[model samples]
Target: EWQLALELLQRMPELGATADVISYNAAISACEKAGQWQMAVALLARMPKVGLNPNVISYNAAICACERGLQWESVLDLTRQMSAARVAMNTATHTAALMTFSSAGRWQEALSLGPGGSPRAADLGRSCGTLLMECEQRDLLAVEVSLTDRLSAAAREGRELPADLALVLDLSARLRRREQQPQELQGLFQALRRPRPQGGGRTWASLPYQRELQLLRHVLTEAPAGSAAAAAAAVDDFGAELGEAGSWAKFAGGSKAATLLAAVRGARLGDRVLEIGTYCGNSALRLAAALPGVRVTTLELDPLLVAIARSLLAFAGLAASVDVWTGPSKLLLPRLRPLRFSAIFVDRWGSQYDEDLALIQEHELLQQAGGVLVADNVLTTAAASFLWQVAHPPSNSFEGAFTSRMLAVREVAQSSEEDWMSVSVANFQADVFRQAPPIPPELLALQAASERLRERVIRSEAARLEKGAFTEHAKATLSGAGIAPLE
Candidate 1:
């Protein structure tokens, strides 16, 4: 059909008929539907040569074609041309352009377009809603809030809500609640963690951590019981798999992994090490494998990821030597007192690094006899406050606290940009500080809230596993509580 459409447009000159903008628009649309974006652009260009000025319709058709083909640049160029030619863009034009931008991850450009002066609020709302969904999918919570704010402003100006009005209001209410909480409490309750896309009989191949899980499964299946050589070979095969997937830079790999391993080795670690972010259990596996007889305690917030990490550590034959705890680091750190870590690795979210370190000091989790602490992804997360506190401890609170050094290293082997890691050694004696700082009342309240949320999640997950589906009452409870139900 598209070929016939193209042929008919080509033969218009031979048939002695001057093709108008309407004829060109039809052909372009056919090409768009067929995914022949190049042909669509060619036809659009041919119109100008044939003395046919392209109108908004012609341009819209061409933009839609480029969008369908995921040609974001072409869509941008066409939109610019439309502006230059004084072709007023309608809702369709804006929608196509925004969709193209979102598909290409050009979120800034998509946002800059705004809900234009097109009188159709419904159309604009639908497009913005779609964009918000995309942002949530990519875990861009900040961008989601920014876009929601823009849409909320439009609504305040009397624009009607989108079809997904619940999502908008829910996010707005969540944001307002977060704003009222204490600064330290804000991070704990900022957003309800959505379950990853591995539920509802989904294929393992579709999981984001599929490759890591696959590697773990392979190692477990291939390695013989109690054979070091076989274990090493299995690990090598896993590395080869990572190479094939070009993923050495991700999930605690590449230069970052090497640097972390080197720092741990150099620390002259004692009997135990604590890792704040387990994250597939890569660091725990490496530490346990590299240092025999040393115990590794790693914490992860997501229960699903904790399961995966535990599986990976068990597969590596290091489960006996490693512990994977499931909960927020803030809540769990306080419970680790009286048992000191020789070395602590802080590899969680960058925003939480400073708070976790402060908590570590307050709880006396690190050995007073020169224990080492290493923090990762400081530069990438712009954790300037953490860096500053480490380099310049306050005289009143942290005098003679740490001897710290900052290192700039590449995140991956092929990455051009560099990230930073801070390695600090404790310098105070245990007798010098008999009394640790008291936990704030606000922090205690936040910890209690987090525990309640964790219990709810545990109950929900247990119910789902037992019943094979969430009951209507459970769904209602979660919805009323502003938590998204597991898919």
Candidate 2:
């Protein structure tokens, strides 16, 4: 059909005529839609040869064609060419990058575009397993190790490590020890390794915890097992029932939301703590379970959410040390004494993530002496914007590399299944806003500068990796490493 379209074009229009943009676009689309991608690319070469020029729309259409064809290298080339010619990369260009990324199963790339919302780290770990399998099939060890590091980082930072990730870890260890075993032999090694259990059903029994467990059951029931009173507790509004342990439910599995939850049966932390978001009491329950040895005071913006979290706490049987209040921080924060907090986790109004961070800092609630603050979804612009605004010469990143890694994360022109859909398709539905980042002139420049430096460093590292010289010492990067552990 593409051949027919091209042949009929000149024949119908006087056998010899300069192609107009519309005529070119029509042929391009016809070739793209017909799956004749190489023909479409060949037709593009005709533009320069025939004295016809490519416009922004022409470049966009051509990129879209290359993108849809899964002609990745071609897509990248045309994209760069458009840039060299100063063609504007409107929303269409950016969107195509996302779409193309998805097609190739390059999920990280897909998720990084203009890029709001990251998948829960656990989901990324799951994808790492799938990618590892694909790499094994293709016998691509270099790509496999790179993907494994990404998986390991996500898992170490609280993404659930699936069996495959564990295998990757074991294999990575073996490879480091100079044993690059065959792919077909992975199962034997896996079977020899003791299986890791899912700590999904964490049991707790302190006074506050039991009651809150009961309340949580009422709110979200069909309890797992072995907790009768917990499974039997009431689920209606918590404030209404003075006896109810807790209420409210948020249906996130740390899958899409990028917030992973571990039901710690026995965990310990300092007495004074602050949390930024309280959707239901999912995190609150886990917090309460950790509080037998300490006190935890959390803040929330919604009374409904507060009530729900409160019930979960009451049901779980620990409500005294936990305070679930609903209101803006401006009003509530002033009430707390300065220098009163030991830890704070930020996970609220993404738009105001920066503001709340400042509040936490200025009020001295978080002392510089080992007061930990874990900010969620910093991968997104909404959170990054706030972070960038609040920066001094030094930034509040996890490490020196955050600014760059966040920006040049190798985005593509598509979203593929092993792609964008893999890490965060669901979260994207809830987040879905990618207009220009809310950047002021100064901060925008700062962000651009940070990204530029980051890109340069990454390029140098990639060069090293390519030269077969990228190596880690026998000790893990974990020991006083630049990256922090989630727990």
Candidate 3:
């Protein structure tokens, strides 16, 4: 249908046929939905040539296309032109501009729009949710994650967004990528309105905070003079503490992790953070710095690296907190009884992530309501293995009540050749089982079976070897021949 409209548009222009506003609007809308930002822009530019002055509708369509392209700057420029043309700002236009700036974490620009002393926060949650969906579809999420920052701001402002906002945002973004014939954004939004856990709980609602979350964390601990919002007002104070660092872009986790972490902290209160694989505290520093006053309990099995992290933390003066747990998570998580974290970040040094997550969940560490569990290396293997356990009769070794709320999961943008990196975030809302008694099966029986088989095969091979009297047979044969092959 859209293609037909565009064809009509092209033909009318070539054949000297009269083209009306209806045809132009239909064609422009089609181009916008096609993810054809360039074509949409080009067409809009030619509107004056066709003696049809671009109206608010045309400007809005171009802005929508620019937004999809993540060319928010272009969106801003078009938005200004709309005002210059004396076009009244509608809710959609204001919302689009607000969303663009919010997605970039440019809070100053986002907040400066409305007049009056008291400013109304546009539904930034809608944009946050929308941008996150874009992150998922584009396969390029490692770098852009400012949604959490906006999320925190919305929560603090007491903005009561529709329960189904995330769904609406996701579907709106998807309208470009794929077709959902019977179901459109309306149905999708309705589905998301179903109740769920609130994010940024003292105990997490879902997953890990990236490395640069320290920015938002810092505001939580202490606010500078003349601040309208303090860190305390920034997010739910889930007993989170803050740590600081100097540089994040130079960290081992890459600037993308730092950028996303900072966004999460800035947007929400992220505390009681956990780092599963703290490699010399490079990424740890980024998270510690963004969070205003949240102590991060980082886990690393290697002793040398643990020492290195400690030294780095001390140098950053964050050693007063940011405790380093120097052992396997399986051993440490259980002992820290009565545990509930706002976020659990996993970056285990090796690729045994499947087993490692199983071990962590088996301990029921973040098994409280509104806990977030984020695992790295999932873009390489981001699919949640324990999702089935949470959903049904429970799988081997995993015991939890929750559903995965994926936020962002993908590889770090290309840094150099010969290196690969990725991360996946899953939010979990914990529940208690009222079904048949919780199963007491092995944590990793599926893996255990293979070990047992390997052991059996090794033992059988040894027994077969022992039973063979090769020496005797060789001696007998040599005696019959009165000669030995080697002797």
| lDDT scores in order | 0.63, 0.45, 0.47
Highest TM-score: which candidate?
1
Arranged by TM-score with the best first, the candidates are 1, 2, 3
Clash pairs (backbone) in predicted model 1: none
lDDT of 3 by residue, 134-165 (tens): 33334433312334334434433333432223
Q: What is the C-alpha lDDT profile of model 2 across 440-460, one tens digit per residue?
A: 554444334334434554344
Task: For model 3, state the Cα shift of residue 118 in Å.
Answer: 71
Q: Stretches of candidate 3 above 4 Å error?
A: 1-252, 259-271, 349-351, 354-356, 359-363, 381-487
Best by lDDT: 1
Q: Give the least accurate 10-residue stretch of model 2, judged by summed lDDT.
A: 417-426
In angstroms, how far off is 323's CA in candidate 2? 0.8
Deviation from native of the Cα of residue 336 in model 3, angstroms: 1.7
The C-alpha local distance difference test score for the whole of candidate 1 amounts to 0.63
